[model samples]
Target: MKSLKITIALLLTAMLLACAGNDELDGLTADSGEQQMYDQAQRYLRNRNFSLAVRGLQLLESRYPFGRYAEQAQLELIYAHYGAYEHEAAVEAADRFIRLHPQHPSVDYAYYMKGLAAYAGNTDLFARFLPTDVSSRDTTHAREAFAEFSQLVSRFPGSPYAADAKARMVYLRNLLARHEITVANYYFRRGAYLAAANRGRYVVENFQRTPAVADGLAVMAQGYIMLGMNDLARDATDILALNFPDYPALDDDGNLSSDYSLEEGQQRSWLNRATFGLFDPPEIPQFDTREQYE
Candidate 1:
């Protein structure tokens, strides 16, 4: 009876070893399968079938979290999401890549991808009035995009993407300045001269290097005149003349010249004040009312 029991125990041990070997072989096969899937995904990506490529990549990532292709797969996944117009998904993936690989050489590319995703995610202006809108024209994402691009420009100035990032930054800055100018113009037309002046001044001070700066200074000059602040108006006019000497001016005769006498200046100033006051009430008492009371 004891001999029979020993034989049974040895047989059981051999069976366990055989099962272990089979498990290892299955693992190898699974690895090879994943590799094949990754190769196919790369082929799809190269062919610009980004959606199918992303699907394969997603499966590889999910099935083999610590696989050898994990890092490259994550980066490519971001690009795939971007190509598919999944802006939010792209940003999320890029952000995850940055968090996971902070010191990775390709981290800069991840940051750049994030910025591009945010920038392209902006909704069209006309889409806002639609009832089923899922995005906004609000520049909230632009701020983040600017920050990311600025970081790349500052840290990796000589990077291949740096030049393009800088150029895009210039465009974004100009767009932001233009938005300010639009608001300033609205206020100016509504006789909110002080508000208009503040908005225009913001554009001039913050976006001095932008193309809109000259126009911003001119708008500020007009705003100051409307507010009856001749000194401020004159200062703005001087800046405009120095910066853009050929800028057209709206004189009493509707000509675009800077040729005017002191009387003409005073008359233009008063006319501007009156016109602006029609839309915006003065903080101080009206000149005629003050004189009559005195």
Candidate 2:
């Protein structure tokens, strides 16, 4: 009974919303011709009234599906959604346009806008104002954006947006590598040495040429050392020496350095000292690569 009542309530609400939307469209395009409606939408776009522009464009497209300006209106709707910060909506609109008009001359623009929307959605408003590390956040949208941009570049190398897409792809690739390194750092902190080493190896193998590659090597070396995998640690250190000789975690001899060393003559706490540090043993300093990013 309760579920039926809820369903009925939802249906009535949807009907009311549909009626309200129709009423709004009727009022906005009362006696306006197709061109006049399009002009009104353009005015909204020019004035930066994105929400109104989206509404007007949507109405115009629905009222005149066969009108000369129908295709243009669909394209503008995508931009209006983007301008209004409805990134997901913008991506959906772009997809619809591409599917409907695959051979459209401006299809490259739609692809570019789709990728841009996903990229913008990933960063969001909070990330702009906050001190959060983007690499530590969920990477779903970032991966999506990268894939979309990659598609744009692959399918339309001559596109005006190709260069910018390529640039963004580079950043996204680095960001992804950094995320892997960040996870490895976390695993190291938690004493999951094997897990950390695997993460570092994954980054090195998959995210070549990224800035985080150096950090990945550093983490791998440290994790292997912690796990008593001396041979693997030496291999990682040798690679680090050849590639990133000046990495902060390495010393003059290219060996891992303990940055967590105690100051000279600094003693343990009274309880620890009395227990000869058996109860609270000093932690071995782990090689941390996070300092570079910080």
Candidate 3:
């Protein structure tokens, strides 16, 4: 009986120790697995295999949502989408990061990423062209980009990315302004003076800091002249002169003159004579018109 009791006690002790060892081993294994996942995801990112990196990071984020690596994984996922040229996906990821980690030290980076994604998402063919139609092209993404960039500039003025964001904002602002000018010019060519003036004024009021401001003012001047508003035309010209004194004006004879010699009224009158009711604009033949006959 004594031997049997001793044997039973030994067995119970061994089982308990075994259970403890198993628990310890499981903890180590879980930690190792998390580290491996993080390392692998980083490796993929380094290799420029962005899609794979995103998948790996996403798995880590889903599996360990409250773990220390979750925030890092989320941020890396944003970068991965960007590297893959998945702009909309990147923006979504960035936005999520910002919403979740509002107080995180790297939240500024998330905002910057959002701006970059918005800027990158603008795929307008006319983006590179000087004269582009603002009304015809979707400016939603560009506007979003501007807003995000502005936020970054204001919030993280000392950030390394702030300078670049500011510069990009300048470029985008000018692009938007040019787009308005293109639309105004299109209206001018169509003899839609009121529409042209409104579009031009929109640029002046919204994007006055852009280089296109001078051109926009000039367009407004022309528009006012066409509308028999010589005073307004001359006022626009005056503003242009004050803003850009060195800007040359193209005369009816195609001569570039630096002189703003005409009084406000005379300048308006000259603009009216130059553009209003003078000649018929060249017709733009529509492709559909040709197709209809064919």
Each candidate's TM vs. the true structure? 0.70, 0.80, 0.70
| TM-score between candidate 1 and the true structure | 0.70
Model 1 spans with C-alpha error above 4 angstroms: 1-32, 124-137, 250-294
Clash pairs, candidate 1, are none
Rank by lDDT, highest first. Answer: 2, 3, 1
Better of 1 and 2 by TM-score: 2
**Taking the tens digit of each residue's C-alpha lDDT, what string does model 3 give over 1-294?**
686687678768956764554332212233357778888788878977676677778777777888889889999899999886789999999999998889999989999999998877876433533454443576788889999999999998988899999998987887777778777766754666789789888988998666777777777776776577879987887786676665556455332233422323333344444666345542321111111111
Worst 10 residues of 2 by lDDT: 260-269
How many pairs in model 1 have backbone atoms within 3 A of each other, for residues 3 or more apart or on separate chains, i.e. clashes? 0
Q: In model 2, where do residues sit more than 4 Å from their true spots?
A: 1-27, 260-294
Instruction: List clash counts for every candidate, in order.
Output: 0, 0, 0
* Model 2 CA lDDT for position 63: 86
Ranking by TM-score: 2, 3, 1
lDDT string, candidate 1, 199-232, tens digits: 8789888987776676677677777766668898
Give the lDDT of residue 67 in candidate 2.
92
Candidate lDDT scores, in order, read 0.69, 0.81, 0.72
